[model samples]
Target: MPETPQLQVQCDAMIGSLHINADFTTTHPWTVLFGPSGSGKSSLLRFIAGLWKPQESHVILGADNITTTPVYKRKIALVAQQPALFPHMTVRENIAFGTESNQAESIAQMFDLFALNALADAKPATLSGGERQRVAIARALASTPRLLLLDEVFTGMHRTQRDTLMQQVRSHCVAHNIAVLAVTHDLPEALEADEVLRIESGHISAQGSPHAVLSEECTAWIQGVTSLREKL
Candidate 1:
């Protein structure tokens, strides 16, 4: 089989008094960055999104070097834990915000694929948690991004909602041939990914297929959570 295209990032950043060093290249269709809180997973995602500049770094997506590329120019869409929708804009306008005029119909079709048609006329403030997340993802897809960065996007979502959203995200990425880097502390969520990476002390300590990377100890720990409806 041919090698998968990857997003390569090498960098160091300061977090509080600690220095975070992340060096990893991921080719998995869905690469989950798993770690404890403050392990720099969020920072790493932010760096990839061009939201945080590293002290010395190089970010290469496929053959393009986007280290200094502006956030808007990188064609990388980010979905944070909290849906950052524009409160003033209707869902339709938010989804079509930066897309070209000719792509509006196509974008709307994409939204329909996500079952977001009815909510298109609703404002952000009126939508429920799941609805807002779906809209956020729809907006991101409208950008026709090369990569999608998800940072704890499953937070605040019910189990069914989370599962549904994850399925949609997976399908969307595969259908669009877009790479994904999902950051999460949830082990079960990480299991849904093609590859799981564990970060600790500013470095990637373990990484492999879910069955390979997730330790027995970690598995046991997650099983204790009443919220995890299914086993990894």
Candidate 2:
């Protein structure tokens, strides 16, 4: 509603001559990079996050062109499929890492926001996959990221767990007005994204609402939504 946050990414990158030219803007708070494995979804995320530099690109967030900016200064947080938590630190410490001295309140909020209160004292080695992911997300949020990159974050969770956590992620992003780019090949995962960009063979095939971009490739989901609408 405020109309402030904006993300624009354009890249002509290559991984071992597997060329990929992607151009897209994240107009919505949550945009999904949906594609099959090896379609360069994760590669694109890496380029945006500054984990990997693209040859020719312009990545702008709000007023800053972060293409050449350092990773920490870009105000972007990436939570990979395997949660990268500090093995030695407790959950509380990990979540408070990016926050400032007034971290007591933020720690409490992360606990409540991600249901991590019960695991506050636990180390990364002792936490389950889902718990680790929750903590990673909390830590990222505590840092006050302007853009969040989620790469296959539901690998270790059950369907119900993934669904619940996804809802939480959406709520958190919306509340903070943080832009999110989620990479996934799962149809159901793409369904939850605010906008969908269909990537195939290192290129974007389509971009729109799920039902719109997926009409031909994913008629089943479209028909399912139609059936539900009819029932309502």
Candidate 3:
């Protein structure tokens, strides 16, 4: 099957009290939005997810213009820093939520691939941070979304856990031909993406392959933050 066309987002929005304007055009399988706090990465992702409106924005998925589409109708899956799983729902229930009846078996297989089968009956409150994030991902994938937005979903994971999840995310996206836009302050994490976009003072300052963008001054600032984060 032909891969789904990657996203094309041009937005101007306010995050908290800050105003942001960003334009991105790329066909990368995985794109990383890299910036420190307050740079508007999360806000942009929220805009794409239909969680927030952009003052003036255009969102095109494949050939359709979904700028005014409602969140549920957008078919976009967002996994935030906090897993946001339902505490009362079992893993199966959470993953199956909003999914078609024919998708249940596929969702179970996905959970098993993530090694979350043992915790299928466990609630989010009782799961570890990594497990919750994994389940959250599984839930998102179960919906067969046209686009996936990941907002620092690996924030507190250990190196091993992070690496494992990253690989799984990449594999799953490729297999499903899903377009992914991930936001993070972690340089190493950003490095795993096929393309990286750097935002600062509410605008896109640089965008390209990870190595290309890493050489720019804005990315240098991001690298400084990443360095300090590693020290902490």
Candidate 4:
């Protein structure tokens, strides 16, 4: 696989009463956008995905200035918190939907990667939440995106399951030279990222290695856990 190119974004936007001004570039294969709810993390992603137009924005992927490109033309894939799988299509079909080639080899790879072989014939309505989320991710990757954006995709998954799935996805992305920018409130998830952007009040307060950027938060979380254990 070729080296993953840098993803650069500079944007200022107002959504509702929140004002967002973020300027950052992703130098690592997997970057985490860490923030509280309503901190404009999702808004920034929307701007980059061409879902929302900011007051002023510039998005560049690799060597191309894709600021004006349409959403479909961006070669970017976003899997939101809600798994939006096709109700009518089977799991296998859903995974194959985004892929242009719909190649059997690639589809089979996704099925194996997400452990969806058992559910291949099942419909969205018949699947568990985690199962659905896995299918959604596999669908996105089937598209073979240059960049993949994840918005709280592991919100309700078990810690062990989330960690395992993330590892698999990261390995797959790295193998394909796909850059990933994921949004999360989970400290453990943030800690796993190669780089992290800590956002506050709709602005980036820090950006660096996860440990360097989130040391304070990590310490507080550890203390909280210790206190809870003592009580129990």
Candidate 5:
């Protein structure tokens, strides 16, 4: 199998109220961008996805400089918090929508991979939030993107459901050698990533193993939890 491309990003710009300055390359298959709300995690993902153009930017995937690449031609998929599936299309049809050539075998694999077999003929309006997100991810994977950007897509799902889906998605991405950069403020989600990029005030504060980068914050969170228990 061919080697997967490395994602290199160096963007410095004021996107609305936030001034984002980020320069990093992905070192793991699953990297999480962790930060508080309004910290510009989603903005960087948008920059990489070519959805938002910054004043200064240099985004390279593998050997290709895709800073100015069009959204459709970039081969990068961004699944936002909302599933945004087409109400008119069935679950299977939505999965096959963005693919240039939707092979039968590939489509079937996505259904099995995302546990969408039961919902194949169901329209988006009939699916639950979790089910819709699963279909959205399945659709993104069908497009065979070089990189996957997830902007808190699992936010509203129940913990058990979210955890199960995360495991499935991570395993699939690792097996296929597709790099994923997911944005999340949830500590548990960040802890599950192979690497974590901690953003603060629109700047990347640290990038390393999740434990090392988030240890201090995690400690404080734990202490607070313990104190609450003691008070109760």
Candidate 6:
């Protein structure tokens, strides 16, 4: 396997009555699946993360075919919208759980990566939403997953907090060449991605640079595109 793995997803499946069949390959360290609500975006991420094994789907990471691979064996981590943290564990302990080894260096790296040093002793109950999300991401990265799947993980965070954490996480993951697939409907989030795939009505309608796809999705709303570009 190469130091930095690339992902190739060639999948076609009927997810519970919603026929989501699409094929695309992404090598970008930070790729975003941008779409509206209930557009089967999360379903695609689930397939890649091994959360839901489609009857006919294959996820190739680097050179390995993980079609029938179990979730734990995939070297893939998923941080959901609502992070399911252990309520009893302290922040530090939570990040340290399920590590492949007692690699203190990685744990220490996470503490700095997500700025979780000060709140090491804090319990999940005491942490705010943004704090919990950051810890969740840090914990996922600590597992040394080759691929990280994020499902609307920054939904409720304030704009500044969300942007800051997203950039911090993206930078760290990109440096490690850990392929990331973030699902979001926010244009800002899509714009931040290195590559963007637009999903509509349960299929990938388009894929390309964020600006090009976003522009196609909103060709009539030219003003909207200009305003969004200004944010970049």
- Mind giving the per-residue lDDT tens digits that candidate 1 earns over 1-232? 2223489989777877657777888868899998898888888888899998866888999789999999999989999889899999999999998888889776877677789887778999999888888888888888888899998989767888899888987887787778899998887788789998889878888878887888774668766764566544
Model 5 is weakest, by summed lDDT over 10 consecutive residues, at 98-107
lDDT of 4 by residue, 111-168 (tens): 9998899999999999989889999999999888999999999888999989888998
The regions of model 6 sitting more than 4 angstroms off are: 1-3, 216-232
lDDT of 3 by residue, 1-232 (tens): 8676768889876666887888877669899998889888888888888878866798888887889999899889999999888899998788888888888787977787798888888888888888889998998988888788999998878988899999988898889888899999887888889999988877989988888887664477788989999999
Top lDDT model: 4
- In model 1, the clashing pairs are none
Query: What lDDT score is found at residue 92 in candidate 6?
Result: 94
**Could you tally the backbone clashes for each prediction?**
0, 0, 0, 0, 0, 0
Whole-model lDDT, candidate 4? Answer: 0.91
lDDT tens readout by residue for model 6, 24-121: 88857788999898889988888888888878678998889998888889999999999899999999999999886777899999999888999999
Clash-forming residue pairs, model 5: none
Q: After superposition, how far is residue 51 of candidate 2 from its true place, in Å?
A: 1.1
Q: Single out the weakest 10-residue window by summed lDDT for candidate 6.
A: 216-225
Q: lDDT of each structure?
A: 0.84, 0.85, 0.85, 0.91, 0.90, 0.87
- Spell out the clash pairs found in candidate 3: none
What CA root-mean-square deviation does each model show from the true structure? 3.7, 3.8, 3.6, 1.2, 1.3, 3.3
Q: How far out, in Å, is residue 84 in model 3?
A: 0.4
Model 2 lDDT tens row, 1-232: 4443678889787887677888888778889998889899998988889989967788998878988999889989899998888899999999998787876775687789888888888999988788999999999888878899999887657899999999888887788788899998888778878899999888888888977876675787678899999999
Identify the runs in model 3 with alpha carbons over 4 angstroms from their true place: 216-232
lDDT (tens digit, per residue) of candidate 5 on 114-230 = 989999999999988899999999999888888999999989788999999998888888777788999999998899999999999989999999999999979999999999999
- Model 2, clash count? 0
- In model 1, the Cα lDDT at residue 19 comes to 74
